[model samples]
Target: MKKIREIESLLGLPSPSNISVWWNMGSLLGFILVLQLVTGFLLSFHYTADLYCTFNSIIHIMRDVPGGWFLRSMHANGASFFFLLMYIHIGRGIYYQSYMMQPRTWMVGVTIFLVSMGTAFLGYVLPWGQMSYWGATVITNLMSAIPYFGTNLVEWVWGGFSVGQPTLNRFYSLHFLLPFVLSVLVMLHLVFLHEKGSTNPLGSLHHVAKIPFHPYFTIKDIVGVVLLSFIMLGIVFFGPNLFTDPENFIEANPMMTPVHIQPEWYFLYAYAILRSIPSKLGGVLALVFAVTYLYFFPVTMRMNVLPMAYSPISQFFFWQFVVVFGLLTWLGACPVEDPYVNIAPYLTVMYFALPILMQVSNSIWYKLIIS
Candidate 1:
């Protein structure tokens, strides 16, 4: 009884009544992170990171180990859904102007996203599959666009002139190492969240609007987890290969290239940004910019009011922003030819134009328009 009361003192809060279903994304992300760590550890036991043994080892796991395929599928699909929920969590934060009050929390969140991307990319290469090979080749080559020592840096990364055994070993080591790092970051994220506290759907941080964390949020989070479990289990079982490429099943051949070569779905948007530009250096810079754009949010956030309550013009534009993001995701999956080839540049333009739109909208609201 005493321990329960002590824990309650740590967790209980007067939270906002207006916080809606979207606020559940953070809870979902936490669940997914723990899921990834567990499944990944199990999968790693049978995984081999060598050039010759890696692909066959995966096959061995699938054939030999009981329920190994199920575990592997869960890990792969879990990564995809983690990114999916994270995007929603970030979108929700933007919607409620959580960034304004908790900029440090926002910064840590962005760092986690970037680190998670790195972790995912490293893990993707461990299977020693075709897409894994070429994907690593294509991305690491981007660093070679740097001015003087770029080629040297690339060689160091790959442990040679190319992506081969040493490269695979390094990626395997980091893939195992980074999740532990992320676990720490996740802890820090929670600390910041608990400190600054959560933003309400109404964008109010009012003390009077606060509520206890246990009975209310704990219950809501449980419901969210149950719902997420159903959807993810369906994906892991029925459509295991849905998000993956057929080429990945084949062994990697440096001499051969697929008609269409792309990263996994989560990376496609950035891949699209990279391909949209003509110059190699230009594409690399744009790719870096696209991913790191959110890093500047603290400096760029000159918000006049909560986004939902701001100008209807901006609200309409926000929906347009969502549409543009979706279009970019779709367009990225399309071939690098014809209409998509032409459409990509324009979409990229609109993609980047969004931050500027938010800044301008906030300026207008605070300055001339509202007054």
Candidate 2:
């Protein structure tokens, strides 16, 4: 009864009354994560991690196992949905400057983001398709840029000189394990969130009245879940292949590489940043910094500008960042030549610079207001 009371209290915890539909992203993300876990677990029973057998095993699941196709489709599509909602959730946090109010939760959320990407990458390689194999090779080989021990680290991860059976087996095992880790991290995130409470859209918690989570936000979350479910199921049943890469449909072949290779859409922006830099090590570092840079935001943007709503300049830079992000994603998919290649480095610079500009503008706004 004590545990039940605690749970009840949590469900009824007060939330910002002003939080909009964007706040519903967190609930939707939770739903997608559970869906992915269930489908992934069911699909794993028949999956073979051997390099030679891996691709065929996937085919077998689709063809032979009852409802295996549905499970596989749901799992694959769920990943896309998961990232989509997570990005929106993170974007909402950024736009509202929620990080400054709850830095601990924000940092943990960023860590979760990185781990989620790692888990997705591991899962991508499990199918042992052409793009999957080469994607693993290309990404793992990036480790060789890590200086003296880089090559050794790459080999150790591969369990051989090249991507082979050991690589597939290890990736499959890690992929299976990381979701459990994500679940724990998620709980930690919620703990931190509950500790600080939700920040309102206006970014001011000062004397703001709160409402119970039950009927108000719970209904909002349900609406989001229903809408997201409609879209995700429509994709699952009508267009499962919409997010799939054509190269991934082919079996992995060491001798034959695809004319163009790219990761899933979620990764394209970072991939563009990687490709933008000319130096191997430099590009790898840029890619690392790209995703992990969110950690520094809380400290950098210390001004009392609760949200972008108060500052027009900061809002302008935020929109610019969003546009740059979209451009990078598009550039990442384009062939690495001429105009596209040239544009990436410039956009990468802006991508890193925009946040700094936002901070500067907001700080200026703060100074003027103080005077």
Candidate 3:
């Protein structure tokens, strides 16, 4: 009880004041994480990790168990919502200079995100459906791009020449274990957050505007969670397949590839990069490095302080960059033939060139503002 009181007291300190509804994204993410875990636990009861039985087990759960259909639908669609909320949360962090003030918090949050992506990838392959199998094959094969030991490592991980039952079992095991690891990371993230306290919109340091976290932010978080849950349930009940690929409905057959083998929507950005380049090895390297490169943004950008806002030109470029990213996602879902292959390079370039453009625009804007 004493320890609890002490912790509460620390979190209750008055620091965050100008926080808006946008700040609720992190809390909302936490809520979605809990929801996913609960629903996933239920689904796992009926799921078999074996390739032969996995898809059948999923069907059994959907058709036989009472209210099982809703559970499975919610779990599947919930992943989409999870990524949506996470992107917004990460975007909010970027916009508000949160990372600048709380570097450790930002780094920890990024780490959690990367781990979550890995877990999602593993879970995606567990169904042993057509897309799951081919997606696993395509992604895992990228490891072969490594300089010397790549092919050997990929074979070792797959436990064969290609994705098979061994890969399915291994993925399932890691999928089950990763959420617990994510929970631990979330705890560490919160610890770091509590250390520095929350940042607000005004970007002030005087501690002028502050409120207790419990009654104020806690209630807000609850309201956000409730709203999100209502929307999620609506999707689960009405449009469960809206976010899923139709190709995944087919059973896995290694010999017969789907006309279009794409990953889950969350991975479309990286997938686009992988398909954009001409060389398989180059595409593989680009995809792997693209994400890992984000860690260097702070140092590479060389900005001592973060920008509060960008110039109109930079803002326009940023939105265009977003559109280009969406286009790449669409391309990723399409067959890797004409128009897609041709446009992939253009989209890929725009995807990476945005940050450079932002840096230039920032420099010009700051110079003009100071002058």
TM-score leader: 2
Which residue pairs show backbone clashes in model 2?
A: none
Per-candidate Cα lDDT values, in order, are: 0.85, 0.91, 0.82
RMSD of each: 1.7, 1.0, 2.0
lDDT of 1 by residue, 231-290 (tens): 998987899888888999999889998778788888888888888999999999999989
Please give the distance, in angstroms, between residue 1's alpha carbon in candidate 2 and its true position after superposition: 1.8
Model 3: residues with Cα > 4 Å off, grouped in runs: 202-206, 301-306, 310-313
Q: Candidate 1, clashing residue pairs?
A: 13-211, 14-210, 14-211, 15-210, 15-211
Worst 10 residues of 2 by lDDT: 299-308
| C-alpha positional error of residue 49 in candidate 3 after TM-score superposition, expressed in Å | 1.6
Best model per lDDT: 2
lDDT of 1: 0.85
Q: Per-residue lDDT tens digits of candidate 3, residues 175-249?
A: 888998999999899888877688886444356667888788888888998899899988987889998878788
lDDT over C-alpha atoms for residue 257 of model 2: 89
